[model samples]
Target: MFKIMIVEDDHKIREIMLENIKKWGFDGLYIEDFNEVFNVFLKYEPHLVLMDINLPSFDGFHWCNKIRALSKVPIVFISSRDTNMDIIMAMNMGGDDFVQKPFSIEVLMAKVNAILRRTYSYSNVETDVIEHDGAVLNLKDSNLIYNEKKLELTKNEFKIIYLLMKNSGKVVSRDKIMRSLWEDESFVDDNTLTVNINRLRKKLAGIGLSEFIETKKGQGYIII
Candidate 1:
């Protein structure tokens, strides 16, 4: 069974989360030590994490960053802060989704199932959907689609797209992309980065997303 980790402080809410998670048939664990949240994370190696924004010492974003450092396990924020900034912050902090306070149990479970299905299914499921106007990057099959056209992407192409798409309009430095793609390598030349960007752009154009990638001169690139 898939394992889920919950990092909520409130006892009643924690119990509710545990019960709901168990009802979905997935094994779940609650963080007992607020200080060593990451320890429970490592011990469980959960497929997903449910984090609350408010904690004893650290906020959910800090925990999310720590977990991201260790694993790419999907993290979803369950918080009472329903502001737009909160949601955006959650996404920017590596959270896959957000559940506001006073949310329906059924809806919460549905979201959990949706995340689990898209994340861990046996089929060629996508890592996520990167939306840019009419264009969408299919993370699973490494396909870029727009106006009914489909462009297949290579491993590097997919990685670049994933990173840029995650950031969207934000300028993603070439170094950032390189770090994600060639982590073990200390150096990746400018030509390599340019080539990857060119290839990705061409593939996107084939799918009618031409001019979708914006160059920022000395900065980097973005899907605007």
Candidate 2:
């Protein structure tokens, strides 16, 4: 089932959207903290978004742009403002579609299903898999597989392995590794980097791949 994240702040509208979304066989999530919308979005990784123009902190356009940076997931703007400028700005802000407020739930469902079909039907094949030794990292699902054992990885861990495995035998710089993490991890100190790397290594070790990620001391890490 496709997951639909609703970023609408109106309590009644959000509740109705959630109920109708579930009834139509989709997983619906309503954002509680407007300021943490992007964080919640990264965690949920929804297939599509229903966004509102006026929100508590950042408007829907701001959040849509942030999501666009991290993902190509479809974002459909649902707003009361029906001006041509609003529609144009929504599209420019990476909105897949715009639904004016006071829409029928059935029409919304139809649009959601249509976008899903268009996006996934012809392009459901998984991409971005990197392999080093016998270990394979699936960037799509953020998981690692080695010797037929599958290990789930957090977003940070996946980015680390992706960078290392993409450059396989080369030493990826610590600074580069830190920069690769999705959000504000660039400001994190060295010890935090060490902790994340160690945790990732331990997870790999648990799956019997102890020497998968090699450290280059004062330099960085390499996958060989």
Candidate 3:
């Protein structure tokens, strides 16, 4: 099922949209920390977003611009401030569509499904493999291919590597890394995360991609 990110801070609207999203056979994730909305976007990698114009920290336009930098995902703005200027501004800010406040959940769902169908139905496929130097990560199958060798990875290992490769050239802090790994409860200490990172690196180096990841002092780890 496709995942939808709900950035509406209003409790009632958020629940309405979430319920309809599930009913429509899509997954839903509600934003908890408005300050780290972009982080949520990266971690969830939702196919689309339902956003409100006003929010706790940053507005929908600001988050839209940031998301556009990382993804081509669709965004639909939901708000009570309905006006020509609001619609115009929303579109200019990279939003795909807009829904005024007090909308029927049915109508909202229709718009959401239509936008997703349009976006995904006509796009050319990106290369399944991401390559650097001679090493490649087969995104389709979670396999590492390098120097005439293929390395298999567990689900957790694949997720770790995917995050590293996706954000290559930047140090990913331990907290962020752990958040991606463990979405709730079960706190993973820094030492355990380090061990897993080491194991993953060795698996990569066993074939050819040694020095694939680097430890940034007091920062975190990164693959570059």
Candidate 4:
């Protein structure tokens, strides 16, 4: 089932939308901390979002732009404002659709289904989630989750983790990691690879998974 995030602040409206969302067979998430809206969004990684324009801290446009930076997940603006300017801003800020306020649950679900079908029907790729030692690496969004703690990872950090995890019990040489990262060892910088490894290790440690990636003096690194 597709996950939908509701970013509305109004308690009544949020509850109503969530109820209808469940009836449509979708997992609905409601935001609690308005200050960390984007952070919560990254943690859930919902397929789509129903955002309200007027929010507590920052408005919907601000959060829409923030989500755009992270993923291509669809975001639909639902607000009482129906001005052309509001609609245009929503689209420009990466909103896939704009639903005016006071909409029927039937109409809302219709729009939601249409967008889901149009976007996901032609896309057959599934997001891969790799789990090891209580840590899950979300390949779809490049975020690491450990014991309920979420950490957003960079592209290289993700690639390094992927390589190591694929060969869990084996030692992956530094050169092999560099080759895997760039596909060309000659173009790889020795220092750059070390820096990325250290950063990746630090991030893992931050989530209480210290020494998750074990480094061998003469050999290389291993996750064992």
Candidate number of the best TM-score: 1
**Candidate 3 on 178-205: residue-level lDDT in tens?**
8888885266666778878889989988
In model 3, where is the ten-residue run with the lowest total lDDT? 122-131
Give a tens-digit lDDT track for model 2, residues 1-224.
78999999999999999998887677989999999999999999999999999999889999999999879999999999989999999999999988888775655665676677768783553334555554666666888777668899988888888888879889999988888874565567779889999999999999998898898988889887
Cα RMSD (angstroms) for every candidate in the order listed: 12.4, 17.7, 17.4, 17.0
Report model 1's TM-score to 2 decimal places: 0.55
RMSD of 1: 12.4
Evaluate residue 23 in candidate 1 and report its C-alpha lDDT on the 0 to 100 scale.
68
Kindly indicate the candidate among 1 and 4 with the higher lDDT: 4
TM-score (C-alpha) between model 4 and the true structure: 0.54
RMSD of 4: 17.0
Give lDDT tens digits, candidate 4, residues 109-136.
6567657866888355232455565576
Q: Model 2: runs farther than 4 Å from truth?
A: 122-224
Q: Considering every candidate listed, which one attains the maximal lDDT?
A: 4
Best to worst by lDDT, what's the order? 4, 2, 3, 1
In candidate 4, the residue pairs with backbone N, CA or C atoms under 3 Å apart (3 or more residues apart, or in different chains) clash, namely none
| TM-scores for candidates 1 onward, in order | 0.55, 0.54, 0.54, 0.54
Residue 99 lDDT (model 2): 81
